[model samples]
Target chain A: MFEGLYSALEQSEVITLYRHINPDCDALGSQWGLATWLKHRFPLKRVIVLGHQKMTNGLFPDSDEIDDETVRQSLAIVLDTANVRRIDDERWQSARQIIHLDHHPQIEHFADLEYVIDHYAATCEILAEFFSTVDQEPLEADVAEYLYRGLLTDTLSFKTSNTTEHTLAMASYLAQSGLNIPQINRDLFDVPLKEYEFASAIRAEAQILDEHLMISVIDQAFLDRWSMTASQAKDQVYQFGGIREIEIWAVFAKDHDDQRNTWWAGSLRSKTLPVNDIAMNYRGGGHKNAAGCKCLDDASLNALIADLRRRLKENQA
Target chain B: MFEGLYSALEQSEVITLYRHINPDCDALGSQWGLATWLKHRFPLKRVIVLGHQKMTNGLFPDSDEIDDETVRQSLAIVLDTANVRRIDDERWQSARQIIHLDHHPQIEHFADLEYVIDHYAATCEILAEFFSTVDQEPLEADVAEYLYRGLLTDTLSFKTSNTTEHTLAMASYLAQSGLNIPQINRDLFDVPLKEYEFASAIRAEAQILDEHLMISVIDQAFLDRWSMTASQAKDQVYQFGGIREIEIWAVFAKDHDDQRNTWWAGSLRSKTLPVNDIAMNYRGGGHKNAAGCKCLDDASLNALIADLRRRLKENQA
Candidate 1:
């Protein structure tokens, strides 16, 4: 199954890797893991990782810069990205050849060779299997650590629904490199003390509307106190997750326009309910269990809550 | 390695399992995983799990009650307990034979046939390997789930320092039973809403003493508001963990003696520093990184902080 990818790597004199914009650990980890392996195997070949944004935590190194002439001579390999529009570097279009490897449902056929296996929990899981099959030697510690980061985070330390025996097996395969698993976990998941305080404050302030619903609103004052952006505050929705009494939770952060009109953008999550329909009513949408929305006013926010409560009641019925 | 264990199980007509008192998932998981397998293999044999205290979260069923005569006729298998003193029940002494399985360092030579491999991440990991080698058929879903819980929690979902390739391999072996991995994770780790709120409160109230030390004191007023015991409040020390700037963190909870005098018992943790020595000065002791202590008065509490601060400064120097 990886023969094409292996052959493409073997034939390419130069390779440039790209992942989606707003790259997460999975995107960067998979891209770096593959790039590290290619550079190790073919030391003479030029290998580059190209992206515009840095990982928010600053754990990973900044992306490499190369001119269009260099891109035209390189083989482009996209990792953990499904759609062309989301790719961080559009220079892939100028590359001599393009390959895409992802664990998301295929959104486009942009790559000459696309390996999209939605069943895999992370792109790193697929890459781990591919590397193990093609190489007899154990993976280098760096390569394994890079891939392990993606696998660990993408599955939320192997708790996500898509995690499988293959996921653990791939993790086991990576562990053979003797990377420090505990330290990697600490590096990847540890929050700054300020962030920890912010998370706790969010949870402490959360309102449990019912046995099944919990919500938190980070108005302009709260965000200003934390020195966080609306999106950053919205990310704290996870603080409300895994509560036995909470079937659905949402976090709304107040934002303002240049003219000073205020609105609220929110992130919504559920354990076993479809929230996208409700999010759609508020001009946003996402997966069944996790979605995003915007409420233009207090009345709209109340309506969204009513819609969510009704959905919960309907499901129970 | 498991031949002795298998033969012992085959020879016994009645078996009773015991684990450490105040059992965590590992103790209960290994005990029940072995008991479930034994019962499935030998339906006529009496398989019982003996303990007094219940799992705090109530995820596992209550322990069984058996008579002394039943114990005298049974083969006792002590699990996850390195010392006899810590066993939940004392009836093991009356059993015809005693076998011990644990992943903790040997604390005593009390059991007749002891199987202690402290190198293994969890007792469940060892049991998973034993079950696989002894039985050709895959484990039942229930048996697998039972073991998975212990392995997952003991290793902190395979992020502990002892977690290795073998641990992941054992987890993969159990996954073959087709248990719902995500559901088991949720069941084992998800906290109640109140507990979540309590954890957040702990973090929100924590004080950062220095670059390396953070602490939270849950005073009587705080405990009264939260409706929590001193020990329960101290358990929230985990909320301070994984902060990048902090090397050592402690949680002190106020407790009252019969004389109506208040004292503070605290849990101390560090990323790399040895804290047990400092704990020893304060009438407590534990592992290098995690320890416990008590301060009889405010002066002693101040003294403990001064000692910890000096230790951090000395380490830095």
Candidate 2:
């Protein structure tokens, strides 16, 4: 994983980390994990993470706020990033040197030095291996905590096909670092009562798609009536019952308050159909198991549905 | 929502229903929404729920199971159950009548009359208007959908101390439907994920109560490391970033694999010491903000933790 990191570290004076936009747990987890490790390891160089906007992480931590001056003078290390468009901040062009570390399936790398490990479960897992390999010093509990967070998210609590033995070993290594498991479990999963109810409500709306699949949606009225914010509605979409190979789920919701913005968000969770490819039609992407995209309006949505049906039929064939 | 409900609509011949355990979501959403309506409206006395486990039903529609002989001779009704424990198996008890319905929370309410409304905001909101008044049927898509699954959980989807005017309005009208919203939301909202995570690993691990009402668990590590099942250890817990509020947030987790299991489950969610009242001592009860008991281990875990310094201070003075 540290193929060129040693040379980059030696040659670079400043480093800024980057991850995919919307800042999922793994992205931010790996970004922050690396920053914390580097900040302590390379006390001589300035280190920072760039581009974090948590549609889900409200007041959680690591704001999207970036320092214009930092990127201009530092080396940029992108974590868990797949595409350039999703870069939370676009100011990394000014970086003196760039390093990329990720676990998404092979996508074109953008940085000067790319360390992509798609076979691993999470970016955090990769970072954990990197941290232990560098062997500069022991990791703090909090740092281990963040790395573990990334590992957990990408693995879907270890339920995803992307996970491997290497991932668990890295997690075990992190656990050995004196990290507190219960504390992270609570913060990471502690859904508010409202969120639970929201989940229940939408789960109530779930309708079995194919015999093996279930799908549901939260219309604007439903969201308004429940007093749900955007993220809550987004989360509640996954509460359908019975997860099987045939389980294909979708949630179509109007984005925000703008009527003109008929943005629909869906979660495709199954080994059956690669929903990510469907998501690619629009300006969205993720792992083959889980991906997303946006649609402009009704016409596009219908066309997308037809295309999805045809592709699904082809898969069945 | 239920335009063609229990009436002499040619003797429903066979009907079954279900609800969340500990009875919440205006229990009637399943018990009353279908059972009573069917008893008064449909014919063919074959009616019953599916199971017979015991739990709190939040009191929306209480148990409505029947006997084996009755299954051969009459109709049955299963009320306010989100799980298999409260199924009116008398239907199966009799084999002639079978039906089920419910606002499936995180917990699955497996049943025959399984018309689960997991997407609506509340079960009671989907029932009538208030706790006691059963007339009229759900009509508007919003109200129908909202009440279709409203008020079956504790967070009350805007109920509790954190409720709003619209929440009450929707609930009040639903209450006027001769169904109860309070009991439904209350019962359904028994143990949230965060509380479970906290109670399981965080609070049990440590009970330090300082003067400023401070109680800190070992941050995110415990959560990240703990597993729900032997199979799930490979899967890490929730993965997210910034790792905020670790210094001081309530924690809980469950000894059982299912987070929804009530008997030996744990809970911990609060900002200050006031949470102790809910985390009570006797009869396994306490105030609203906090409360916990042994969900499933069959041991007096509460008493065990009661001796711990932080909680020991709860009943003192």
Candidate 3:
């Protein structure tokens, strides 16, 4: 399945890598790992990594600049991204050929070529398998470190449901290259004092509504108080995650919209319940266990809560 | 080194397993894992697991009950614990023979036969290595699940400084036995709503003293308000851990001693500083990065803070 992708990498004079916007460690890891691997294997090839938004962890390198002409003549590999809208660099569409590699379920057939393994824990896992199969050159420690970061972060260090025997095997194979697991972990997980403080405030504001549904509202005032943007505050909703009693959890942060109506955008997560469909109904969506959505007003928020409560009851039954 | 222990297991008709007091998942997993393996291997033999304080996670079964006479005739194997004071069961002393299987450094030699590997990620990893070596029988999935739990929790899902290539290898070995990684992860890590709420209170109460040290003080009143014990509230100190900019972090929870002295007992953590010696000076001790101490009064707390500040200055200098 990866043969075509491998061939393209070998044939192309220039390669560009693009990850999803607002990227997580997995996205950055895959992007950087592939770029490093390509640069090491084909020293003469020009491999560039590009992304718009900077990662919050500050672990990976900054994005590189490439002109439209360069991209038009390059092989573009979009990594850890599910759809076209998420591709950080729109120039990928203008590339000579596009290869989409992802671990998410096939949502849209937008890519020219796709390598989607929905059951795999991460894109790095798929790449690990590809590297082992290609037999051109063994994965080096430097490249392995970046790939391992993706595997570790995407599975939440192998705590996610998609984690399997193969996940550990791939991780062990990468570790054989002497990746610094502990240092990478600390670099990715360690938070700043301000982030920790903001997380605490989010937790304090969490409410267990309807005995099973958890909701946390961070209005504009709260965001201003913390000097944080809506996305910055809503990201802390993960602090409310992994709770046993809360069947479904959501964090709504009111956007500082200049329009006549105030809107609240947020993220939602669940351990066993289905929240993606609910999020989709509210003009946002994601995986079954995790999702996101936005509401125009307080009434819509209440309705979403009611719908979530109904879903929780149905799931329990 | 495991020759004598394997012989003892084969010879003994009654076997008792012991773990450390205030047991964590590693302690419980090693205890139950070895017991389950032995029970399956030697069906005629009696296997009992004994512990005092139950684990907060409540993922495993309750500790079994056995009288002193039974222990006296059994081969007792203690897991995870480093010293005699931490042994949960006193009857282990009366056992016909004692075997210590631990991953911690050799602090005090109390057992007759010791299998201690300080560099191993978890006691369960040691057991996994032992199982592969014994060759009499293979490790079953049921036993592997318990071992996997220990490996997962002890290393914080393989993020701890001690995690090694062998750690990933041992975990992969266990996963090969069909362990449910995701379910076990959720069972172990999922927090209760009340605990999450209390963690927020701890964070809200956090203080940045001396511009580098972070502290969260939970008085008796605060504990009462949360309906939590001093230890429970103090555990929230982890909420402040792995944060950048804070040289040292501490959680001081007021404890009402029976002797009419109001003491403050707490846990201390640091990202790049040594705090154990200072903690030892305050009537407690632990590793260089993590430690604990108890103070008898406000003056003692102030003195400890001053000492920490001085230590920080010295470290910086």
Task: Write down the TM-score of every candidate.
Answer: 0.96, 0.49, 0.90
Q: Interface RMSD (Å) of model 3? A: 1.6
2 or 3, which is superior by TM-score? 3
Pairs that collide in candidate 1 are none
lDDT, candidate 3, B1-317, per-residue tens: 68988998999999999999888888988889899888887899999999878875667899999888999999899899998988998889999999999999999998889999999989999999888788544478889999998898888878877788788878877877877777888788878878877887788888898778989888988998989998998788888777777778899999876795788998988876899998888899999988998864788888888888888999878
Worst 10 residues of 3 chain A by lDDT: A255-264
Off by over 4 Å in 2: A1-3, A52-70, A136-138, A229-232, A241-246, A256-265, A274-317, B1-317
The lDDT per prediction is 0.90, 0.53, 0.85
DockQ of each: 0.79, 0.02, 0.62
lDDT tens per residue, model 3, A92-175: 999888888999888887677899998899999998888878764558988899899889888877887678878887887887
Q: Write the per-residue lDDT of candidate 1 for residues A63-168, one digit (tens) a residue.
A: 9999999999999999999888999988999999999899999978988999999999999999999999988988999999999999999989988888888999
Interface RMSD to the true structure, each candidate: 1.0, 21.3, 1.6
Task: Supply candidate 3's per-residue lDDT for A60.
Answer: 85
Candidate 2 lDDT at B250 equals: 34
**Candidate 3 residue pairs in backbone clash:** none
The per-residue C-alpha lDDT of model 3 at residue A214 equals: 81
